[model samples]
Target: MARCVLQRLLLLVITMTLPMMTMAGEVSVAVASNFTAPMKVIAQAFERDTGHKAILSFGATGQFYAQIKNGAPFTVLLAADDETPARLEREGVAVLGTRFTYATGKVVLWSKKADLVDAKGEILKTGKFDKLALANPKLAPYGAAAIQVLEKMNLTKQLGPKLVEASNIGQTFQFVSSGNAALGFVALSQVFENGKLKEGSGWVVPSNLYSPIKQDAVLLTSGKANGAAQALLQYLRSDKAKAIIVSFGYDL
Candidate 1:
């Protein structure tokens, strides 16, 4: 009986230590739709350094708020604006003191073709198209910027009815990329990659058009005890990570 017991104990010890010795379990994240491109850069770098994978769910801040409220299994959140993480902390959904701004987002009016827009920002006067797409302001920060730009130019009265609403920035870009809408408001980073434009042409919306998009991050209380979760938060703020973020049309 003693011999059998000794063998069983050895087997259990190896089973427990084997995973810890060689692998990092993936961390799950709920990232704001607008931050998708930059997050990809951040994730790739993090994985190379730590051997841990980030499983990301991209969507609107409002929808993420709803999911976390209903007990979604997410370890971290990178929001499109500061309000969501602030609210999550207030509601006891995220770890207090773990929330901070990660990036500032920018919005742009983009077209699949250069001729479709004018540098003077007079695409509206061109009159070659009818539909304009933007994220739903209620759900997305960039969407709200699109509305502000229209209001600033006093074109909201004429363009309001022609607006096509996307549930999130990803969908907003998709609408234009697929030609479902002639032009759309999307994150400046969407058409850009590694500090260069990847597809199409765009007019960067003026900063005066809307409030700054202060994106935030937090460690969900559900994953408070996780070493990997904290590691991810730290990784995102590292100098190397910041370089990639800046490349994606965001400011640290």
Candidate 2:
């Protein structure tokens, strides 16, 4: 009788505890490389607060656009530029009326070594370094912006031979960070901490130097029926997420 009573008590405890466990769902997101660090922080908080998980894949927005078109199984896209998401919406690959600007990013002329980049970005004209890094202009919005800045200063031809091009902004940052290149153009969010550049010297490029980088996010047709996808999209616009984005040097 005692053994049977103990077994019944254990079963009752297990049954009562099961109802309190939340059934979490996953949402796959294609995130722009510039947004990677902030997205990691946001994903953790989202799962903690809502019991929903976000699976993130980070890369250049242009590459992501091609991947999505080729039938990559991504439910949400956090693009580095507004145009790509808009194009996807126009192409009918993304859900209509689901696109929104999530953040605005700035490009910066950055050097991992302190004092290498002057406040006015005079280092470019001086050409003190053997190699200057930048992303591939054809694939990254930041890279295009860097090109515009170079053009505005008439440094394109002068710096062309000395340039080291990476496929994406993240790789451009790596070039500078790893000391392979003396300096590079990277997203402000990459080198900033607590509203300032972390350990390096950088010049925050003027917005007038290039087109506005209005980063946007959209839900793909694949996510149309996914509750977790919709919820994650909504959560991105929440006050908490906004606070995190701003802290990472992105604009609302």
Candidate 3:
């Protein structure tokens, strides 16, 4: 009789726990390529803390905008520029007033060789390198900032032929990492952490050389019905997430 009672109590506990386990849901997020590393850290923490899962897709903000318009089922957008999220809000694709600036990014002219890039980025004027890599300006905000820096230094015309453009900031970083390009422009976050470069040498471009790269995040219409999506966005603004972002060399 005691054995029968114990078995009945164990079954009751298991049945009660099943409903709570199913409460955890998944959220799909579209993230900017520049934020890949930081987002990976944030996503893991979000899942651990809330028992929810985050499905991340990383690419250029421009490409994400196109995909969202074409009915991609994204629950949230973490864009490389504030403008992209603002536009989505105006177009009724994202929830109004749901947009918020997440981080401000810095651009850098980087090279894998320790001595290839100078502090002032004067190599652009010398035009000695065979190829200079940058993201496609039309598709990446970081690429646009890179162009602005070149134009400010009067090297645009001189370096035009030597330019190698990638589809996004992540690919632009890869070009230099693989040594296919002598040097390239990349997000500071890609090669930096704890206020220092992880590898290679780079010139942190002056703020005066280009416009601010204010990144933003927003909840999308497709995600409005998903509670997990809203929770993820809220978690991104929490102190824990902010610490991770700062650790990755981004400005809040």
Superposed model 1: Cα runs more than 4 Å off: 1-23, 125-127
Best by TM-score: 3
- Cα lDDT tens digits for candidate 3, 1-252: 999999999999999878767888999999999999999999999999988899999999999999999999999999999999999999999999789999999999999999989999888888888899999999999999999999998888989999999999999999999999999999999999887999888899999999999999999999998989999999999999999999988889
Q: Which parts of model 3 are misplaced by more than 4 Å?
A: 1-20
Q: Candidate 3's error at 210, in angstroms?
A: 0.7
lDDT of 2: 0.93
The count of backbone overlaps in candidate 1 is: 0
TM-score of model number 3: 0.93
Per-candidate Cα lDDT values, in order, are 0.87, 0.93, 0.94
- From the highest lDDT down, the ranking of the candidates is 3, 2, 1
Structural similarity to truth (TM-score) of each candidate = 0.89, 0.92, 0.93
Candidate 2 Cα deviation (angstroms), residue 93: 0.6
Please provide, for model 1 over 1-252, each residue's C-alpha lDDT reduced to its tens digit, 9 standing for 90 to 100.
Answer: 999999999999999878865767678999998888778878988888987889989999989999999999999999998998999999999999999998998888888876686666788655467789999899887888888888888888788778899999999999999999999889988887766668777788778888899999999999898777888999998999988888889877
Q: Choose 1 or 2, whichever is better by TM-score.
A: 2
* lDDT for each residue of candidate 2 in 132-251, tens digit (9 for 90 to 100): 899988999999999999999999999999999999999999999999999999999999978888888999988899999999999999999987899899999999999999999998
Report the Cα lDDT for residue 140, model 3. Answer: 100
